[model samples]
Target: MRLRFLAFLLLASGFGLSSASQEDSPRIGDPYFHSSGAWGQDFRDQWAFDAIGLSDPYVVWDALGESPSPVIVAVIDTGIDWNHLDLSWGSLWTNDNEIIGNGIDDDGNGYVDDRIGWDFLAGTNQPWDYDGHGTFTSGLIAAEVNNGIGMTGLNPYARIMVLKAVNNFGRTRTAYVTDAIRYAVDNGARVINLSLGGPSALELETAALDYAAQNDVLVVVAAGNEGQDLADYAFVNHPAVITVAAIGRNGERSTYSNWGPQVSIAAPGEDILSLRARATDTLMNITDAYKPGSAIVGPDKRYYRATGTSFAAPFVTGGASLLWSRNPSLTANQVRQALLQSAKDIGASGVDQFTGHGALDIGAAFAADPNASIVAEISSVHVVQSTDGPAAEIIGTATSDRLEIYRVEIGQGETPSSWKPVAQGRSSVTNAALATVSASEFAGASVWTIRLIVNRTGGTSQVTLYRLSLG
Candidate 1:
């Protein structure tokens, strides 16, 4: 099981994935119009935004250019308003294998004219949104950025596959969800988002979910909103689904959000602003900003604030999409593990019912994904024989069959509950090297951890402690 780590202070910024060569990170356009989550500045209004580490997703986007077209993410909810200004068709999934406007299942995948995606509820070629939930969730996952119409999501360039499983009325049948899952897996979707769930499980839906898992497609599902503990999640319809819970902007469990052990992680779910549908229909019936700055007025469109476990699940879904964009070869399980490992522990110590592993930290997730290969540990915790007196200095070694330069990080804390980075690198050695920690700093800290991670320059990174040496 992955144990949750306490929230460290704003980590060292400008962290890039450096190979032994240590080249600069890849480039992209400027960031959206909000406070970027880079240097620890709190964009107070959207606490969930910074809480989930969305402050600096642009760093990943800048380093990793465009996501591959085939790495499509299927949002299985109410249909999306693909024509919204914040959504770029460039990032929208198109079934090029099938010809559009032709009344035929050209790709022979059982659907006709699925140009971008299918509408399982309406059984039509147009998977457009008549309601706002799908649109809200979609914008949170992959809103077009720097093009400057509205705000951005995790990966600005991630490809989205629209699947309408929930209708405008917020009603859904097991068959609709099951069929949508099958459709997404059949297509090139690497990640599937199910922002809707029921109070009970159906055999067909369970089989469909298992099928996605078996086929190596990661499914991000929402824990029910009953606000009651039901096993792992507060309440769960599917006992074994990759469940998610909801937290407010302040990083507390939402009053209506379900919780428990079943929850994997959490994200900003309260009044999360995203793309608004052209139609007046809505799920929460919230037409405009309930408060000031809640919704952003765009050039051609508007993004409104929404709340629910439904909105929370997309944070993980979008994260999975970005990881795949960084490296498509990563397996579904690998993606899931990276997310769980990088999560921030909140509320109670370790994994609690309310916040699961804690709120999603995309920056940490990027740094802790499957790219790094070095393992480090504190070899010996010894007090140095100083010329004047006994002092503290940690000695550690690392081993990586992979030839790459590594850097050592020394963090100090008064108690296990908190840690602050005391020292960072200048030493970059290949394969084998001793980690150097300052005696003065080490002596001051009551507790500490040593990290020896790769200093490679690739577009993507894994957010992990690598081999940790707790002192």
Candidate 2:
């Protein structure tokens, strides 16, 4: 049997909808008759969710199957209640190195016993949502699909690394945020989503975002809800960040969503339906903000309908992860740029400060040139100094047309241009094509700079050195 979508709109400062009940949730057609389809699939919701593209990739059936490599999207927000009925399973990210409840820093990455993602808000391992915001964003990003319930996330199998940088009271210090971003990067997060924003242009935050860019991690940040131009907003202005603005069902800028040139793209942000845990909204549950009559509640978990740029950012984040996961060769920049370029321009034709490149379009992203010869990552750069000799190893991966990997450069200086290769080596296909160089490759001990030069498109390929930092 087909189920109708139970979406909602914000009627007040908290979770709400009119007097609508679960029974009153709207559907466009007659009651759905069963199709010989896979589990956990929702065709109706896909149409509602695709404020970006008209076509639904998930309807392709094969797209519902698990990918070989699921990308991890770090949701750095209030935290996530992954244990919620709709969100507790599937590719929700867990720290593989961490052991749960042992009370020890098993992985030795500082935070202890963080089996699931870390909670920087309380400095604990369990990132259970203290507020409902993260869970809502998490569902929009990846709420597990084909399992047969609720709404399907943008990317069905993409993992969510729950990082709670914001407190229950809706406050965050820059230090916590900086550490959270670094933690997400170091712990194998391919995409990071920041659903919270403020007016502050802090130095450390900018530096942390820069660090993420250097490490080849994509960051999707939310424009604030003050409904003003955000050209001066540090996070949105940063070249590394994909700043998102909220659009409504009518394909217009959200009244409460911030706008301007800094906005990278627009996405559905009004009355979005997502998973919400009653435990997190105890105070809001009693007030008019809580729409009990309309609440789709049962056994600890209920669905919420809310609006903000907070919800819009995750659509782009999930899109980026889905695209990158499908083609492991695309560089972080390539994935970000290609997705931006594929957007369906809205508002005043072409790009504008209000919508940037316009609304997100996920289905169009599949048309990206898979053999575009992308150098995806530099996983590690390590130096081992022993009694025999001193050596450095550079390990990274590349895509299809990559001819070979040669030249590992390390330079220490204030100037970025003044760097040279220490050693040259060949590459072979591992999972993706991997290049290896070590032992006697060391140029200097105080190496502050690391560069990997990959040659694509034959000798006609110009030496594009992928620059990174050991510091």
Candidate 3:
């Protein structure tokens, strides 16, 4: 009986139909479905959530208070399944100026009846998912949380603005994407996630990116999966775009992810479980050879497990929306700074080529203060004779809008690329003991650079430099 069922499913897949009925899919009452041994493998699914520090978002929810304003995020890819069980209709961005199903260009933006969003592929208003990439990414960005049915999204306060530009075969030209970027920016989308890209760096696409940046919209793109260095990929390296890389369950760079100097951050992208679009078998068809029977995650066949930088990009997109939802006053640059500065550093200290700043840490991002500025100056530095041998006492006055901690670091030479922390203080000080650096550390150096950094609640910091003569 099982062999016969598998054969029938394979036949259905060949005909471009869903292997299982959508109505009979898993729900809350099916106690065994999500936790069942066949589907879940117990915590193996949804491991990305914990990896990004979203294991329990209630603390963030509590910090955000009752209801934060919704941030609109544009998903420019294959269309999304808006009616998916886990996706909320209320969370979708609606165009108040346009009348739905009117067959008229009510708002005069060119596309007629673009109530929710426009589909450049089908040239229609109903931009429903047929290729499944958009649906998968949308679910990652704004799937309803605590609904007791499927996995929770990173941001519950985001309104997804679906803009379908890619076709059913996951192929898209630069023109379609450029048009979609303009539409998203004009339609009040604060963040745009581009999970599709090719090698070409067309002028049209760069112009659209500039338009978005000029309009104060944050655009996030995925580093290609070619596994080759993308140091010269102009599209992903654009100043206006935030290029993201992929990390696996172990928090290391995914074997297939491309890396380069342009990568701003990394996020979970391996074995990711998200919504499976109806009548679409992109994952099943692609992974049939290497990993069979693993594409379809649940008995209900409503979830999928796939891996790519495409999936990793949405986690940052979702994080951007959540940050905007909490602060609502952060500029596109500020949001980008907070995300990068607050990342959990991995692979290399400070910043590196592979992971950029590091893996996404949404919890720390929520606590970041990108707008905070420091007014500080180093007063003086003097030699102090101590029993421990030659120590330098540094004095400084530093203050910030939201000062939480301050650090003093010493490095060899008058201009050092890196500095070592010598002392740290929690409170604001006025010409007080900012740091006490031991001369023994840099025994051979005659001149040293001392840095005083004022850190805020978030990972953002402001620095003041001073050169000291240690002769």
lDDT of 1 by residue, 154-213 (tens): 665567899987777676777777888899998978988887765444467668877887
Best candidate, lDDT-wise? Answer: 3
- Candidate 1 has a TM-score of 0.67
lDDT of 2 by residue, 380-401 (tens): 4456564656555455543335
lDDT of 3 by residue, 4-118 (tens): 0000011111111222222222332222222322243433356676688765566666677677879999998888888788888987999999988778898899989998898
RMSD of each: 13.3, 14.8, 11.3
Error of 1 at 346 (Å): 0.7
Task: List residue ranges in candidate 3 displaced over 4 A.
Answer: 1-42, 232-234, 284-293, 372-471
Q: What are the TM-scores, per candidate, against the unseen true structure?
A: 0.67, 0.67, 0.72
Error of 1 at 10 (Å): 29
Instruction: Show where candidate 1 strays beyond 4 Å.
Output: 1-32, 35-47, 65-70, 231-240, 281-301, 369-471
C-alpha lDDT values of all predictions: 0.62, 0.63, 0.74
Between candidates 2 and 3, the TM-score winner = 3
Under the 3 Å rule for N, CA and C atoms, how many clashes does model 2 have? Answer: 5
Those runs of model 2 whose alpha carbons end farther than 4 Å from true positions after fitting are: 1-47, 59-67, 282-301, 370-471
